[model samples]
Target: MATKTHRYRRVTPAQLQTISSLAIWIPILFAVFKLKTGDTKFRLFIIFLVFGALVDSFGMIIYYFLSNELFDYHEVFQILYLWYECLFFVWLCFFFLNFQQKIVWRNILLICFSGLFITEFILRIVISSPNDTYSSFIYSFFLVTSSFLSAFALLRIAENTGEILRYSWFWILSGIFIYCFSSFFVDMLSYTAIGRGIWSIRVLANIIQYGFFVVGLLKMNKAQ
Candidate 1:
């Protein structure tokens, strides 16, 4: 008889952190876009995030009313969640073009995120629901990877300017750190009976993360 081998897959805490950081990007993207653009051209994107946020929150609210092992509503909620999830990457791409950096690595990262979005779109179509395929690896990867690089660049800029504390990078970095760390618990919570409770933490973290972005935006306005 031949021996059989079993393969196991795992997501590291660090990876989970990256994934969780995605929650904050929705609001951060909105704040930055509103700050940068004056016209109504990108207004639709802003509305998308707002609508997605509302849909996601509504889904959470309805989750509490669902019965065990008979979540007929889950299917509908998952569809909305998947759609809401796509907005983050779209905003990230828009934000990247407005970023202050002009380096080869940044360009490569932008390209990678764009490619990931395309892959994610296809995956969403194939899966069609969070229950079918909820990992959202590509989205998490893009958000986390881009955040890491952007945070580093901002830190460097802060250092070179000799005004680190005065710069917006400090707040942005702190927000990213908090958002990333919270993602691990959020992911674990998603699979448990108490998952919704943990997801509440994710919402709190998002609020803080977006607050930091708002602070950064105000700083930019002051510098102008």
Candidate 2:
């Protein structure tokens, strides 16, 4: 009975939910890539996406091993984590820019983000000191800017169609705003008193951030 209870407690509902959601996101991102891009780019982007996922998986595995002396590669995992993060932004740029439009605002916005994307790539390679600080700022800027743009786009659609997505960009933007601002301070706090390791607060922040996107995606799938 004690062993049974321990087994049940080890695999909690939240972990199960996160796994299920991530599983769903994988297929959804693949489908979106298939429908939106050329065969070559879609395939290449998927390769990078899956590779990034594997890097994250490997980091988790390495961390597990490190904690138990099963193996040790914490430094390697840190480097891979940086690569994983860089690829995520690159993937986002590819995903959006591929869906081109003649619309003036869309073109303008893409151009702006394209410049920022290039900067991020360069910074990823060149900026070495206080790497986390720079990365956090870049990511925060991306999230906050993307959220504003999404909100604006939704508003434009609502104006034209008289129907907006339920919970829609509002929820997504709120999530972005919350995390972007929260993470700025989280980074600052890490430099100060927190000692700079992964904390529960960061975990919770990420959950809320991704949860917002998941809910928005579900609503979109339902609407379609």
Candidate 3:
């Protein structure tokens, strides 16, 4: 009897997207890190970006190894990645809120949203699988809400400070707004026909969003 061998197939479009984005991100992140040596305001955002990139890269590696398995860990990785994504956006919102001199409103909203997120997370874990549609919906909703709230807060600050266009956070919030606005609908209809049609659109939105992030980092470098 002859031994059997398996040949790996070409990468999928999603995997290609991850690889391409990382290629763009690595150099930009390095430049940003060098420029933001002592900047504290963007520390958390930078950490999140690097971590997200690593996770995405690891996910692609897992895909290559377990692509043929019936009960592989790829779905688990995806769930964990989605959870991190939601949590990071929440952290970003809190970071933005810290800019406000008065903490009362920020505290109230933070408490409420945090509670809601915890409750939803528990429900998701107890009642659904990691790959549940409802879990994705909930996570996407949280991200979208956090992004919009952050954008609103940044705008309020810009209005009061009178140099909104010059602020790096303005561009960051703009990117978040574009990505989350498009993603909100995608998440809602992720299992539907419309979702399939909008998949390319979502990818385009993400690319644009990350482009804004690069632009924001460049502006910060100039400002410094």
Among these predicted structures, which one has the highest TM-score?
A: 3
Write down the TM-score for model 2. Answer: 0.47
Q: How much RMSD separates candidate 2 from the native structure?
A: 7.8
lDDT minimum window of 10 residues, candidate 2: 90-99
Instruction: Give the whole-model CA lDDT for all candidates, comma-separated.
Output: 0.51, 0.48, 0.64
Q: State model 1's lDDT.
A: 0.51
Q: List the residue pairs that clash in candidate 1.
A: none
Tens-digit lDDT string for candidate 1 (1-224): 99999988865543444443456455546456545633242344355446555554544445455554434444454544544444443333334343345455445655665565545545554554333233435435544654564455555656566766566545555565565556545554456667644566666676676677556544543342
Q: What are the C-alpha RMSDs, in order, of all predicted structures? A: 12.5, 7.8, 7.9
Model 3, span 185-213: residue lDDT tens: 77777778887766766667777878777
Query: Distance (Å) between predicted and true CA of 79, model 2?
Result: 7.8
Tell me the number of clashing residue pairs for each predicted model: 0, 0, 0
**Per-residue lDDT for 132-203 in model 2, tens only?**
565566555555555454444445545654445474334444454455545545554554456354344544
Off by over 4 Å in 3: 1-12, 23-28, 35-38, 65-72, 97-131, 221-224
Order the candidate numbers by TM-score, best to worst: 3, 1, 2
